[model samples]
Target: MAANNGLRYKDKVTIVTGGSKGIGLGVVQVFVKNGAKVVFCARREAEGKEVEADLNKLGIGEALFIPCDVSKEEEIKNLIEKTVAKYGRIDCLVNNAGYHPPHMPIDDFSSDDFRELLNVNLVSYFIAAKYALPYLRKVEGNIINMSSLVGQIGQFGAVTYVATKGGISAMTRALSIDEAKYNVRVNSVSPGNVWTPMWNSGAQATPNPEKTIENGANSQLIGRYGTLEESGTACLFLAADATFCTGIDLNLSGGAELNYGIKTMRGEKELPF
Candidate 1:
């Protein structure tokens, strides 16, 4: 979809999970600037209120910060109920709350660790979508799922995170089909190496974090980490203008997801998957 000078989301109502920081914060800012009233939640009350106050002061679009722990079904249910209660209708749901624990191999994690990861990173998306679907159907709205390049092609030491992201991509496709009859579109945005606070913090866990981040930035074909703004734009495009698209995984990778040329040169003939 192409951008226009007009307010794309004028008067639209949106719900953004994890809107306290990173890509989620960017999405909230962009939507508010475009004239959509946003209801966003986070586990941290202080950060959420700070964001809410900042957005409200902008005097563009309205923003509400609801403190929530998305890992709980009741909380997600309450989030959706509160959203519809205030707005009276829901137009878009951006499922963006997820985290990757420090890079670790499969055997490093216990069953409980894996289960907790699954609950917060993956299951919450489904629960949020399930709760929002009925009202989304009423408005012919859409859902934007945040997947990752790590999910598509396994990230070396992030098996658990990769699995959850892959599940998101798969779920997005299935959901599109289920929601088609109701005219609600579903799609995923998969980002490669973004330089958000979450990414920076994760990188800091390594020895020589400066070197690690530098190596990551230089590894990108674009010679820089992807910005949260880029991801926000992709999401806004899917939500406001991708009218003909559904069940699609739109990649905003800075060539990080593409190593076909190097792989081909190395004579690798088959994909691992």
Candidate 2:
């Protein structure tokens, strides 16, 4: 179903990481359009500011851009502090910032490389949650972690990335159990082949970019790649609508995990309306 664009979250305070582009941008846009007061951060100040300015012009919600590198613990702490100081409370936190390096075999990846990837993709989420929890507890807020379908199913040539995502899903469950007493929820969204800048970059790096993209799309039961809006809407659902949900890892995989073998649209026909 299509997401409702109405102002369902009017004035709710939210923080989203990596909100300058891709799935993060989509989450920010969805939250803002739903009448939220969002503080979004990215390493790129210019892009963050641009997103903030453009979103603010919509006149539906407020957007504040903060420059941050999530790999640093201090930066994550500061981000939470600044948001709480400005908004007085945080209703939701969306941990969406992540890095997916070029595909390579496990043997080719160094321990240091794996550690660095963990810092960016997994450790940052932990740090953000550590700092944001007190405020979230105060308001009974929720967290929506951005995970990946590969975290569940395995992916070849991406052991490091898969490890990080798997950690996120595990952490989401454990954190939710710990925070449930405070009425704060923790959950995750695992997406498959979402159409984002990172995906485009990965595709472009391949020898046959078009064929690579086509294969990626065909991997899902759906005939196309998932959209940013779809990813954003899933987060919104977890944050705003799934009141009793916690420790749940929602899959936005377009049925990619269903059945076995390669997915194809062969012999498909449209049904009568």
Candidate 3:
């Protein structure tokens, strides 16, 4: 399918938040490959510079790395400013930055935890959109919010993370309706179990890490976790190809979302007793 003007976004400009690593980086790579000029930002200077260098070496598309904290309104504004200054217009915004801490029950969660998740996962999108909307309006662009499966089907102990993702889903829907008149589109991709840095960190720390993740993997119909490429492909579909689609939640959960609430029962032989 054609992406922007001629099906594929050959010269479109895109901004990807949290572009230094993980799914965000994956999205950046895909946009670059598909002929989009990508501007990505993250808090870490080293990673940003490294990724910038890597993409520059490819010589397929231009990549600009801006050091940014997505939660800060001023930084978000500056990010959009820099991108427009260089690219002249914004065609798409990928709100992909997020924070997921170790699992904790709602009662055990601290106030700081809630604030942190809101700043990164939910509020950041608001800030980014506030600044990017005008440029997007110029081109009738699109916004792709990164959501999670846990939000749709609440996890046992990840209350704060799930809440933030749930908020993103709702916000995307609301924003879509509000922005449609301007011909702009807003949508979200809900990834289930993706094997990115976040999952790696969780896996290494979990008790019997390998076995724990293995069991989690088996729960999915694919019998495996998702890759950065998989999530990136989904983002590309929403951003460039889905011209008539908006306010939709595309599940990249490998069908795991369909198999809900079925955990290993107690006293089962699978227990590590």
Candidate 4:
């Protein structure tokens, strides 16, 4: 027999939560380009409709967008059910929906903010996996959880967000072991900084968008932040090509993970105070 065509997820049915925009949209774009039938979801119906139209115009494999709030178990269930109903099976699930509230000191952080962070970042993954497990198991499908470098090394003023990231990392390990026997793979991708609508939107309000981008870029050892295209490539590899990869977190942090303390200095030389 010929060698297996292992790198491609062609014709694979995929679902990406929070896919209306940002890193999630990036993942969806890549999947569509690579010949997968993909369905994505977000709570914003207008954005979802617009992206759906844009993807359809590409004439790639069919794309669908469902209105969903991944934080709620019922919504998660509906998101997966609708996807499977549309595509027949789920070969891959990309849990990419996330939120990062305004940064605040730990003591100053509200309990509500902490709960929102956990619900969106950590619990949503569990909710999606629970509903998608049956279909995923049928095809030995894979799950890719979106995480962040902040979780690995806590961000100075984002306690809640950091906690969720840390929890997802731990969850990835345990869940991977749990799903192994069922032939379903679970992995995570922790991105450093990817320039997407999310980043751009925030930058618009800043005094200097270019400087913000530059500072963000310089924080990485690679001397630049990431693009959605780059992050999407990582997602594609993890979701389809990594057959034996599970319980692992592939950090696409532009080498930021390698140099922890340097980014905080803002490319400044220390004064001999």
- CA lDDT scores, all candidates in order: 0.89, 0.92, 0.87, 0.84
Q: Judged by lDDT relative to the true structure, which candidate is superior, 1 or 2?
A: 2
lDDT (tens digit, per residue) of candidate 1 on 144-192:
9999987887776677889999999999999999999999999999988
TM-score (C-alpha, index-matched) for candidate 1: 0.93
> Which candidate leads in lDDT?
2
User: Model 1, residue 83: what's the lDDT?
Assistant: 89
Candidate with maximal TM-score: 2
In candidate 3, how many Å is residue 83 off? 0.7
* Model 2: residues with Cα > 4 Å off, grouped in runs: 1-5, 262-273
Using lDDT as the yardstick, the better of models 2 and 3 is 2
Weakest lDDT window of 10 consecutive positions for candidate 1: 264-273
Clashes of 4: 0
Better candidate by TM-score, 2 or 3: 2
* Model 3, runs deviating above 4 Å: 1-7, 264-273
Report how far off residue 207 is in candidate 2 (Å).
1.2
Clashing pairs in 2: none
Residue-pair clashes per candidate, as listed?
Answer: 0, 0, 4, 0
